[model samples]
Target chain A: MELSLCNISYSVPGKRILQNINESFKPGRFYGIIGPNGVGKSTLLKLLSGIEKPEQGEARLDGRDISAIPRKELARDVAVLQQGGLAPVGFTVKEIVRMGRFPYQSWLGGESVDPEPLINEALESMGLTGLQHRRLHQLSGGERQRVALAKLMVQQPRILLLDEPTTYLDIGYQLQLLDNVRAWQKSEGLLVIAVLHDLNLAAMYADELIALHEGKVLARGVPDAVLQPDLIETMYETRATIIRHPELDVPQVMLAPGVIKSNGLLSRSLEAHVRRL
Target chain B: MLLLAVSITASLSMGSAGLSFADVWGILLHQLPWMPDADTIWSRGEVAIVMQVRLSRVLLAVLVGACLALAGTGFQGVLRNPLADPYTLGVASGSSVGAAFLILFGFQLAIGVWTIPIVAFLTGIATLLGVIALSRSNGVMQIQTLILSGVILQSFLGAFVSLMVSMSEGVVNQILFWIMGSLAMRGWEHVTMLLPFLLIGLVILIAYSGTMNLFVLGERQAAHLGVRVERTKLIVLVASTLLTAAAVSVSGVIGFVGLVVPHMIRLIVGPDYRYITPLSAIAGGIFLLWADTLARTALSPKELPLGVVTALVGAPFFAYLLHRRMKDQRGEE
Candidate 1:
């Protein structure tokens, strides 16, 4: 399935978050949306998920406007992993994961197919089998994210929109999560779009990068093409050094001394340079 | 279920008339048309007390309790706030005001006993509409705004009820009993009024249990999970409001049964509304049956207000729950 945002514009009163943004995504690939905070990356995901409609233009699925699709029908093929994952409500791991079949279930809670196998596989994938009966709050942040990932797996949508799925994870959990997602994308031929704060992790896992800045598409291409030092500096307002990985052909971003300090200095000097011209 | 059954039996047999269990059962069995012709073992007065009075009162308690509890579950689930209930949303007050107006003006006979409950149902719906209308901004209702709207309408209507009551001359005592709530003289008609709404509301709540569980993750997550968030919200609101209004109309503004019963069920059931909804109904029946029984028997003929009994018991339990939650939150941090 193909998902594309066509001339999408969204704004709150007195502010424009996204303006005339255009992007498209394809199956069997991982697309990383990267930008500084408050740049509408999550908003883009919300539009694509059909949770929030754009003020102008549309998000289309398989060449059909997503808004025209009923929410349950749309959910059959599209799933969104929300930001910060689940809260500490009293639902157990298995119970929450079982809810992935909600769109397929009737109001009477009957599903046509046996979801047990799918649920079992998802639980095992996240290593949540033992903790299936444990309440969400009892789990650690990383565990909760994994539980969330387990839920997404059971949802088994062709298109996955992730909003900072790893916000609260440590480095080890982060790599573990991306590895599982990467493996699933390769094995299942699913389209995955993630809003990633960690550019290096995005370069490692994402097949392509869609760089967003100030609610506009700054660049979209392979990670190697998009993660250039100049683009990084322009997008983040900080001087960054991009170096090739010693073992693989992906670029890693290393910020200059004092990331915040360099951000101020570079932005100030860039302003001065523009003034001089 | 057993507890509920036992409570019902106990309530019927232990009314002020002091009928025995055997006599109560014999009276009930004798009333059934299917029973073979049998000699009357109980007196006319005893039969009247059992069949006409206590039987209907017990059934009304069960129905009203179930109604309030189911409505409470809906409110808590849709709002994603554990503190949310019929009273919290001002829906109970909305219906209360309608009954108060009807009684203050002696309009009770205009439509018979049906007048107060019918009017109450309409005003409850109207209050919900008002809350939903005012809560919305830019065609969306944020949780904070929805809750704030409920609070505002609740206090506003509460004062309005007070004003109307103060304005009345002779009916002040009557309105007070209704507002404070009682099942003292309620009959089979009151039972019939709440029964259909309870069944329909229970089904609606159960069907939406999945959506309500999703809502615990917050509205956006539920929407992302294929729920038509606004539609779900509106439907649950209307269905539950139907329950609260009908219940308040029939039984007056019974306090804390709605609030305390569902919360207690959630604690046992771990917040799954499928379990919470049905279980709260049965448990709520037991709760209010006993509370009403206490209201009847505790103070003898004086009959302490049913709402007062509930509040007396429920207030401390509510306080404990708040304290425990505060401690739990602090512990989590």
Candidate 2:
């Protein structure tokens, strides 16, 4: 089995974050996890990435317990892109990307195989070659996030996990970022499990979608089956309209958002928002 | 290496005795076994001053500076706080209390002059343990909790030291002067005492310098990047704490060098720990060497405190660098 969870359960001091999660993720495919906030999406990612131990069950990769795998070996197999992206430290773009080769380096930072070509290639792919010498603080948030992605690209992990990596990007750049990741996932024959807020993007990119609700897997199937309007509404507790994409064979979601006052006049804020639109 | 050698030679020559560089070099070279003992022209008095007095103190200053800087770099790297230094946890203050307690009770020279330094070193280590014990919870030491715990220990120990200082009216002058810090008359003993810690800490830091770079992203990212975060942090923390304690034991609380030297290195060399770690040690050595030289020779016979010299020179220089960096960032943006 690839990275798989067997009856995983996690809890904080007074709250249960995840409960009885049993899922086996295979390589050579992309999976998207969608849920509302506080539904344990990131927590599950942490468990799979071996950063967090499940309270009840164990996460396993390749038939062995994930936590039992030495960190460097595990890192060589898995790379995680944390939520909010990397912070603005003073490292240059090249330096940050080069760090992705840590698992392959020696105590004195000597790598048996030269990583310069790989780092240079990753930088080129992310459109960061021009800013390779610039410090992280000098880059905008979108550029910083791209730098993080470039770092992971050089890592060449078998499993790439992302948590809201699109938070800082504009729509154009978000599509560009995902397109790069998707291309890499296909070419490298790796697995991509991303916790995504944008249901449409999840539907477009993920081969399979896992919908988490209240710390459990509510649905798991092809996007077409998982993204049904009733299931989306049940998971998010908000009305959503689902339609097949005109250009792609995927379901897209449109928020059907409104609130009614007792007097039945459009709320002052909604009227103002409509007027501005 | 060549610069450190030159700086050490220059410092050895220019004391209140006013010897030249050639005289200093001759005095130093004359002691070499292969060099002709009869070829030495320096007087016994000059030799004594250079070999016994200035050479030892200058080397001590170099060792102390390098230790502080190395320790500071490790602290800043692991804690991911630019403001962290050897003194951040008040180990120096804790050490001072030990030294002061012994001095006030007239037990400083009871077991010879070495007793105070030994006691100070013990207390410094004890304080580190206390900080670690306080900060750690559920086998996890978060950065904020660690820093807060350090601050708590520092203020408490600082108050304890003040109380001791107030109670000892007779030896208060000695305690205060020593606490202000001096590298005076420290012979081979203090140099040898601090040497092993510096060498060991430097070696450990070099091996882990790669992981230190990941620390800038934070502990969580460092773990994800395959660093054994808890193991690395604890080993680095203990090593740096010992380095700081050894330095403090010999030289008292010589502040500012540890706090500013690493930042200066970061500004010049950028944030790669591989470079920052070694560069900080060397730069700290050079900075403290000169500061000590100025401290001894600036006022000549009076010999100003080394701590005052470091703060006076370091603060202004650091302020200038900071101002320039901020302005550069603004201009670039």
Q: Which candidate has the highest lDDT of all?
A: 2
TM-score of chain B of 2: 0.97
Q: Write the per-residue lDDT of candidate 1 for residues B1-333, one digit (tens) a residue.
A: 988877887789996678788887777787779974334577788888877888899889988889998888898888877788887778878988888888888898798768887888889888989988998876787778888989999999999999999999888999888889899777888887788889999988988887888888888777777889998998998898888988888888998888888888776567788889899889888888888989999979789999999999888987787688778768866
Worst 10 residues of 1 chain A by lDDT: A256-265
lDDT of 2 at B17: 80
Please, what is the whole-model Cα lDDT of each candidate in the order they appear?
A: 0.86, 0.89
Q: What lDDT would candidate 2 get against the real structure? A: 0.89
Candidate 2 lands at a TM-score of 0.95
Instruction: Quote the positional error of residue B306 for candidate 2 in Å.
Output: 1.4
lDDT of 2 by residue, B1-333 (tens): 788898999888787788899888887887888887623576778888887788888889899999999999999889988789998877898899899899889999888989989999999999989988988887888888888888988889888889989998988888988898899868898888889889999999988888988988988788888888989999889889999999999888898999999999888988888899999899899999999999988888888888999999999999999999999888987
On DockQ, the candidate that comes out on top is: 1
Regions of candidate 2 where Cα sits further than 4 Å from its true position: A260-277, B38-40
Candidate 1 steric clashes: 0
